[model samples]
Target: MSGSQALKADALDFAGDTATYALSLFVIGASLRTRALASLIKGASLAAIAIAVLGMTVLRVMNGAPPEAATMGVVGFLALSANVASVLILLRWRDGDSNVRSVWLCSRNDAIGNVGVIVAGGVVALTGTAWPDLLVAALLAGLFLKSASAITLQALRELNTTGASHATPVESSS
Candidate 1:
């Protein structure tokens, strides 16, 4: 790829990664408002992992080789951690509310994405090519975008129903 192409690719990757982190805040924030403590903690953890991955990927791109590989190794581990934690947390959620289910689905999607990241990292290490790394980064961003949209929509729905009650109000006999 030419210098401009490489730069564009990097820009896209960073933007996506940043958006992923930003969405994590929403997840964590929504979980807090809903009083889902476990989900909150998990969201926080995932956010941290995402930041680490972003940092590492940037460092790898700029630095090169062994260091890049090392960072990719860390990304792989963190990806696994994020996935496992998300799955476990989602499993504990009892309510089927759309908001909660949205969160659960995000976790489920992320877990799958994490596996892709791991594979991409391994491929990069084996082949010493940028494609694998870039592919994974793009895939992660896609996953983030998908989850963020779902969560935001669900949260809006929840907020819109603020005054609405599932149960009927009792009528006064006056």
Candidate 2:
């Protein structure tokens, strides 16, 4: 991937995460069903991001060019630091319901992806090629997809449980 393309993809990632986190905040105080719905939305958003990154990476591979290694390394480090802070903040709530878990997953995945990008930057710097960037992008896309799948599944289960509980008849005593 080219330097500019990587930067653009990273920016989109940040924007998507920010929007999803904001959505979570809005639904935090709602019912379990609502929070599960928020998680569903977040999962869909993450899947979309994964698809978008995959597409971009494939195109970058087809038309290969070297990324700016120094820039990539610096930006990746900055993103990594931000993700670390987010992960730490969300860690306490990692075991929460689907909505909170989605937030934690997003932050955790981004932190891992940032490390991949930093490694890619170092590889590109040493090799003077774009393959490392492409590989990192592809791997990050995979990570996003995996996280999305998990969040989606958990949300569906929670929703199903909520629905099942509602469907059960309550017993009464005389």
On a 0 to 100 scale, what is the lDDT of residue 167 in model 2? Answer: 98
Could you tally the backbone clashes for each prediction?
0, 0
Give the best candidate by lDDT. 2
TM-score of each: 0.50, 0.92
Q: Go through the candidates in order and give each one's C-alpha lDDT.
A: 0.51, 0.85
Q: How much RMSD separates candidate 1 from the native structure?
A: 8.8
Predicted structure 1, TM vs. truth: 0.50
Global CA lDDT computed for model 2: 0.85
Clashing pairs in 2: none
lDDT (10s digit) by residue, model 2, range 71-171:
88888899999999999989999999999999898888878877887888899889988888888888778888998999999999999999998996878
Model 2 compared with the native: what TM-score? 0.92
Clashes (candidate 1): 0
Kindly list the per-residue Cα lDDT of model 1 for residues 1-60, writing each as its tens digit: 221212222334334445444544565545434523333333344344445455555655
Model 1 off-target regions past 4 Å?
A: 1-67, 78-82, 92-95, 102-106, 163-174
